[model samples]
Target chain A: MISKKLAATAVLALSALLAAGCGSTKDAARPAAGGAGAEAGRAGVVLPLLTSPFWQAYNNYVPRMAKELGVETLPTVNSNSDPAQQVTDINNLVTQGVKGIVVSPLDSAAIVAGLRQAENKGIPVVAVDVAPESGKVFMIVRANNRAYGEKACKHIGDQVKKGKVVQIQGDLASVNGRERSEAFNQCMKANYPDIKVLEIPAEWKSDVAAAKLDGLLNANPDVKGIYLQAGGVYLAPTLQTLKSKGMLRPAGDDKHIVIVSNDGIPQEFDAIRKGEIDATVSQPADAYARYGLFYVKAAMEGKTFRPGPTDHDSEIVKLPNGLLEDQLAAPLVTKENVDDKALWGNSVK
Target chain B: MRRLRELALVPALVALIVLGAFVNENFLSYANIISILGSSAALAMVVLAESLILITGKIDLSLESVVGIAPALGALVVIPAASAGFGLELPTAVGLALIVVVGALVGAFNGFLVVKLRLNAFIVSLAMLIVLRGLLVGATKGKTLFDMPEPFFALATTTFLGIPISVWLAAAAFGVAGFFLRYHRLGRALYAIGGNPAAARAAGIRVDRVLLGVFVVAGALSGLGGLIQTGYVGAINANQGANMIFMVMAAAVVGGIAMDGGRGTMSGALTGVLLLGVVTNLLTLAQVSSFWIQSIQGAIILVALMIARVTTGRAQE
Candidate 1:
């Protein structure tokens, strides 16, 4: 009886594992051979991870934008935020004989080995969102993350003017986190001399943001404004905490704490519409996909870019690492332009 | 001696309370106290789960992933495809049940591997953690599920006698588990099994079945923990409960639960969870530099563990 039961349990466990394997592998699996663009040269797109809405939006736009640009691309492989897996994915893509690769690296320093391998294989790479610390790439398509901090600061500063404002920061270890935090602090010091910025480094976790924001509110009940570093994670928790404390007054109310956030997720736009937040810097997800494929396609055809102006109201700058970056336009969206048809968040159903 | 072990973390918690009082006057206020408990609720549940498993000479590192994927899968069933779900649009009640059920299923599978299949528990759980985390990212496609039905958020939003329901639920879980472990016959058998499975089997304690039951229960607890977290955060993101096992393990170890097995109390684990929560809230309220906050948290945990060691008359096993 014991042996029979043990065999049954083993079979059950194996089947369950197989079921989960099937369910999750559908997205990560390489597409079947001879698809619509089999004649066209293929580009491999590797995502850092899909845990955040910003990356998800970019992922959704990749195929559509690729079709529009007539670029044949493989089904994007997600590194799932593992630097080692990212390197492995790059190797796998190279082995598949892709003409070029587009990748958004999770860690700048750790991505070097992957880039080096692709370089050795002579497959050009177009990096999006995160620029690798040391590597060769066809182009880096990203917005000024520091400007994200400054724009948030100006919006909150213009409204709050003098009293204390809490800036819920992301992890200090990350480049985006450090840049946004330092830029926001410097801007506050330069532009609004009297405004006190209370900083809470939340490490990009919503619960941490909510807990820290809650405790901060308890001590500084008079905080006049709030700046959330990443609205994708922080928006709901911050709003819910404020609402629970009965401090989430409408935008025009005297007790309202002016809030500015980053990321252009639909929820942020909805919050702006409901007067829960004042403004957000709409990080251009559509532009990222457009240019990620655009440049990769260009690189595949032997076209090169230089440090200068671009036609899309942006600039291509050469970094200290000798890699060229096309800084895309990331506009600040307020209630006035929250409903703009061109903004990617507005288009998401 | 066991009683002393259970009470070892109390002094550290008390010291933290005193420090919090001095650091910020609002630290002891009723509202701030509730806030601390509310924030610690999810961590407390996962700690409780780990404590149960640790007492059985096992660990479930995948409990952290359970806290993410369970709710993500649960919410996915009720949401439409346009919202990044499978468009099942299942009833909210079924969706909620699915969270705990999925968690229990994962636990059951883990138990099968570690118990019947005789695989190494640590490696099995670690692999499960990676697999479940990947499943969460794939299933959600990296989108945060927002605008869920009101019942989903009601647990964290609603209050009973001025306390969030999640806090109440966590407190009840610790209470019930502590009572059972201390006084119940079957619970004592679990201790015996963890302490020495060979001896436990010789004593006819049904060692394997009890161990399997413990794993399933732990998984269910983890699932409920995720549900409460979903309500607390107001939405489910693919990254929920990411890297939380470190905190859960730290709290369990600091609370005097033995990694080698067969020792510790639910009260000890609960205090461990509270100590971390209090320190985090105090640091934030004190306006400590964001960079120093993590370093300070680590130092405090080390000091607490030292205190536990001294009081227990030995280092934790």
Candidate 2:
């Protein structure tokens, strides 16, 4: 009888937790269906993860861009940063009989199976943010991540001329993280020979970055500059750590650590205004959404394109994997251009 | 003998400190030691939570998720909608209380499933972990909350006697838990239950009630750990507690806690947390190639295990 009573109380608590869990996953996983305009050309978008503000911004833009481009899109399904789940989400979208699909892959190699399944279903897949290691996609919508590293190097190198600088990197196992780290190190070596780059493999985790960075700063307190790979995660912690140590001097101050970062989020803009950080390479979350739908729509229309410049400023380059990637422009945002009405971060809030 | 086993990791920790000093001149500085202690505070709290659950012969993987969702939910109701909060503007104290309450509630639910339903503890907690993680994503809409009230960041920011309060809290938690497990009657009852539930019940111990209480307290501890983590990180993100379970388990198992239950000490677990902390700090100070850090860290952990086997005079089996 006591067990039975306990079971009833358990049911009550489980339902409350499950009730909240049910609402969000349903909103995320449910494909848009039961439309009166069934023939209005529907596409499915599968997000890699929504944990990062960059992805959240891209998620917010999807429906608006789809409407602006005059295409009906199913509400996006978040894979929640699971490669296997991303594949399952794609198969489900194909089963729903959507005409086209847009996906930001969680893994470059694992996503090939999903792309292949979509191909077998005769649904054109537009890959965004991350390109598949090997797959046939209609178009890859992304910024040049290597250039993100190079731009940061130039920004910091121009000012700090000679000293130890730190680069708080993302997960090295990821292609984006590897490319950025390699390019930044190479740029520092070639352009600013006098500067030394100390790298922290932060794995896109803020706490790990902050802790290791604290240790790093302790060892080398006179470090001149810092390049944060992902500002969305690292910015606050980096600033917090620097402030605690009395190292977060303003830009014009003699002891300020000239900071360059990736991801031009609103927080980064505010930091730039306050002179906590100097510049950032906006990863073009808005363009990724706008053009991910734009290309998927073109594919649905049975359109074809060659590798070159498009009406939009982005260039289409054919990869050795027999895939085409439309490299979008990721502008460098500093104090001067931080308030520009054109930057996505400025427009987000 | 058991007390000596708990101190088994002390030699390994000293050796690592010696190695760290050799790697760099600044490695022995007062500032570096304080930084390592402060940063390891959250992990130490989590290790304590997991150790409590382990001591009871039941594992709770959901403690990791509790570390995230508890604090996220608390912050969500108080901050403005611009910060992705619900805009209730609840009192900061209430928000803090809500974090502990949510954690305790999750623990209670897990206890009900495991004890009342006779479900497998592993599967039930694993499922709860996933569910709680999803709830966090949904509650915060995957947006990182930055504009928390000042008190939310207090545990990490406030310092006493030249050390952060977070470090002191973790140390106190371990001390209290260690003393209870060693000397208190109820703490001895936990060992009796975990060693053999049927035998323990035959001895007139209220096994079910005590087990349920442990689960509840473990959950509350994890929630408090989450609160401390938020202050340490300076913000709360949906992925706050992601992958923390592995570290918690590592610290507990390495510290001499038996996975099968009924044998471990708080000192041993504290040693495990310190070992991992010192190794990470040493590698960074040595300027070891970042690519090689993970491999070297794994190797050191294996060596630590071998040392534990020698010190305890028994294999980990």
Candidate 3:
């Protein structure tokens, strides 16, 4: 019999381990300047781990942008993609009395309390990359995940006029995951009536993605394209699986899967270079540095911010909380423009 | 009743295949069957490892962490430092050996705490699970490792008579383990110890030693599984084994291994992994709504349990 005690322990252990990784590294907060003008208040910059080149570019740019904006950045903390721990770190920031915070939360819903705490305390917060569920955040500046999905779908639609396509969706719990899944499916349905969509929730796990993709490829050998939501995690396995099946080929090959992936990470760039995959949605790291910091500084200065035409190519819209959100430009990165120096992957070095 | 319970998994397997065939014409395809077996390879080892421990009145929650950390340690040394890795570039042979050593050391550490220190095995392993996970994140700095030599995936990539070598490795592990549990005296003592530790000790079965041995074996299995998993995934992320314990525990318990102690089979555990795999494959094949897939998986497990109980004429536990 499974003991009640064992069950309880199992649950507690899962919660604790799952909760541990988001990072509770409490950096001493910097105080805001007393006077206004360019002397904006000090802010906390919490980004995800810089292990991947995507975040490395952010790690490179955000603080530099903060300095140019005259905001003193606290030593950055890496959330490492655990949502709950991010809450702890943000709460720590709140307690440190930082005048403002710019956080790239791992999950949207899981960071509500952390954002709400900053809101309740009247500290301006700029949620970078992910928007919280219900928080009094001043602004959200993120890559439009829906647009990324649409671009991926359009890329696939361009490659294959009518055929089966697999959407290798990311983790479903996050806002990125949900939006990408919905918009890609919606785009495919609207644009390509003859294209059948098969959904595989690989959850950013390479093996799961590889295995599910293998099964689907085998079941439908003539499948024309694959839209992988997270390229950094999926590219390696996707290539390996395709190569093993003798299906990995450059675009324009008679029999090749027109693979379009999201997140312009270095791995995706390499795949694009090799022509093993067709394209990727480049979510520029500078968008976070520029817009994410701008709104935080504006909110701190007691000023209402509005998006401009030249500001990271973002369009302004009302967030759920009635605050204006700017959905930043996410460009489709193809092998043709893989060497674009303006892209984050090219700029990381 | 127990014998019937052990055999009940066979009909469940057949029924799932039949149901899958009815639902999807591609169900019986060579690719689909190979997909099921391929997916089951590494998981089967973890299931057998957990089964051996549970039957010996213990659990190793860190087995999953072992699966994550051992390969991570290997990768840390082999990958370049500029890429946020150590860049030691240890030879493939050394990396492979290190995987075994990491697993053995971690297992021995867990065994020492539970057996010698007389600490609660559950709590200790739970803590080790967290510590090892942390160590992995620290070691890799949350980077995903993928540049290992081709030999790293030899077991997964190569095939013997059109089946992956991973399937063969898993089979050999199951064969040896199943034979040992069914015939060997040392293996017999494991059940005796788990069934009644005090009685087993009085009867000179060396309960503590057998329990420690089970943990070591479980750890080594986890290491082998780690190699196979690394090969299968083709890359290792920092979060590799994050929620793997849930699957391992679920597989063993669902396969008729009593969570408390003292009963299970290789066939039962293999069936458990395959059933889970098949159900997963079915959901994708049937194009079941994504959100409903998890609920459907849970439902199938419950249905499988009810069938087992009905066939055995008693509650599974």
Candidate 4:
């Protein structure tokens, strides 16, 4: 009887634990206010992707900012990474009488219709991280991806005098990848005429990048430099491959290879300091959240706004062109000042 | 004749190896071979677990989700101490023990639905698959769980006696599964159940009990697979075993395991896994485009199934 009771209690405890586990941090990040408008109480804000650290930080800061502003924010499910899902979420928020909606578009094209739907329902929509191609979005807050790409390529050019350079690109379908690759290619063509850029698609995967690197090495044995756009998660395996082939080294080492990657993830910063990589471009994740919320707030006020440009800070403030662009400036991280915490601290946060 | 039939997969595997060697010299390198086996080990474990269920005339579409969930659960137990929360950091042994217990519980749940509720295995396991996958996504917030214990990582990357730890683990799992299906009365009972459920019942075998046992074994092995996989990749993601069900099923079918069930060996399953791994390795070594890999995998499976079916038909005639 005692054993039976014990087992029953254990099962009860486990079931409770499972139930608790089901409530994700993303759900907890929602605004606590009950209704939509400021007068109606608190409102909910949903993000498109929760898997990425950048998005998670976005989810975290949005609610924290909402709380400080005395507003309620609720995060809805956009887990599918589908524009239809985002559209549905926007419509649902509108039905719930939400004062405003902040969305990071899954597909720039598909979200245009969704934004129009929200607009039709009189719901203000602020685009975050990525902007819709349609001019309907109130504001787009994001890092300057093209400048980031240019800075990354320029850094890589500084490392190698001339030879074959392999560009490890992210998913080409993504707006960030396309813009970054374009900027990198533009910089390469303008400055490094002797350097040959072989764009090898890594698909934003470490193993894939490593495999591609192996093939690239086998095909082009004398490749002197690599420009990686996706940061450490997709760089580790390639770095290991290079290490195995005796290509990576510190300042005094016999062989030196230039690596300029993006998304200054913690490990990438460590790599830069250790000289395994030459430099990296840091995307301000916290700024994405802070500015993303500012855009939502501005939209909610029924203020006239222009889409921001990719090169300058728009935040909630008016821009020079009175247009809000989705891309922001890319901060460069090099071996000379990798220890500067202020520059790369936002990425780790 | 049974022994020869069992060894039939060997020739195809040998032929593939020779073809690979001729196609690419790098395919014969030690590094490439080790990499192939290492990559295949996780999939091999999934196939082994599915083989047990197939032996009992049941299919588990839920094996994929089970693989996804186990590592998430294991990660929860392992990563929290180092990261988010402060708790007693359990060793790999403890983590594995918890994983097995959780797996068995899930298996028993599946068994209960099939036996007591009398749901179709196909429908029941598929539902479980979706439910578990949803739960995994929600629990991890779709982010990967990293920073696993060092020992667990070692289980994936380390070698013992010049053999990868994963290869050894696969071999041991196969040996144990083969022995269970051969010597044990319960194992024999499973085969009887798969061969004919009505006859099994008439022969005084409790079909429900045997099925419950089969599911328990399948789930336990899936748990083991999850543990190995987490160690293999050093992280767990929501889609860790997504699209793996088709691969597991194909490997089993190609290994002479009939779709109708009661017709395969653990040894054949291993050979099927190794054969597929070798083909993939060869393609990679030859610098084949990624787009061709999936099509080639499909073609190999079709050819293997044809050969298996023809050979089986001839023996029956």
TM-score of each: 0.91, 0.93, 0.92, 0.77
Each model's backbone clash number: 1, 0, 0, 20
Tens digits of per-residue lDDT for model 2, A147-265: 99999999999999999999999999898998999999999999999999998888999999888998989999989999999999999889878876779999999999999989999
Which residue pairs of candidate 3 clash? none
User: B36-137, model 2: which lDDT tens digit per residue?
Assistant: 998899999989989988888999999999999999989998898887899898999999999999999999999888888889899999999999999998
Candidate 2 shows a clash count of 0
Worst 10-residue stretch by lDDT in candidate 4 chain A?
A24-33
Least accurate stretch of 10 residues (summed lDDT) in model 3 chain A?
Answer: A24-33
Task: Kindly give the stretch of ten consecutive residues in candidate 1 chain B with the minimal lDDT sum.
Answer: B308-317
Write model 4 residue lDDT over B1-317, tens digit each, in one string.
Answer: 66656655777778778887798666666666666776677788889988888888888889888888876776676666434312446666777677777777788899999888889989999999999888887877666666566665565657887656977988898898889888888778878888999999999999998888778878877877876666655556566676678878877867766667777788888888887777655655555554355577578766765665565554421
* Shift in Å, residue B118, candidate 1: 2.5
TM-score of chain B, per candidate? Answer: 0.98, 0.98, 0.97, 0.91
Arranged by TM-score with the best first, the candidates are 2, 3, 1, 4
**Candidate 3 per-residue lDDT over residues B136-180, each given as its tens digit:** 977876677877877777777889999989899999998998889
Docking class of 2: medium
Model-by-model DockQ, in order: 0.53, 0.53, 0.38, 0.12
* lDDT, model 3, position B41: 84
Off by over 4 Å in 3: A1-33, A37-39, A48-53, A307-310
Interface RMSD of each: 1.1, 0.9, 2.2, 4.6
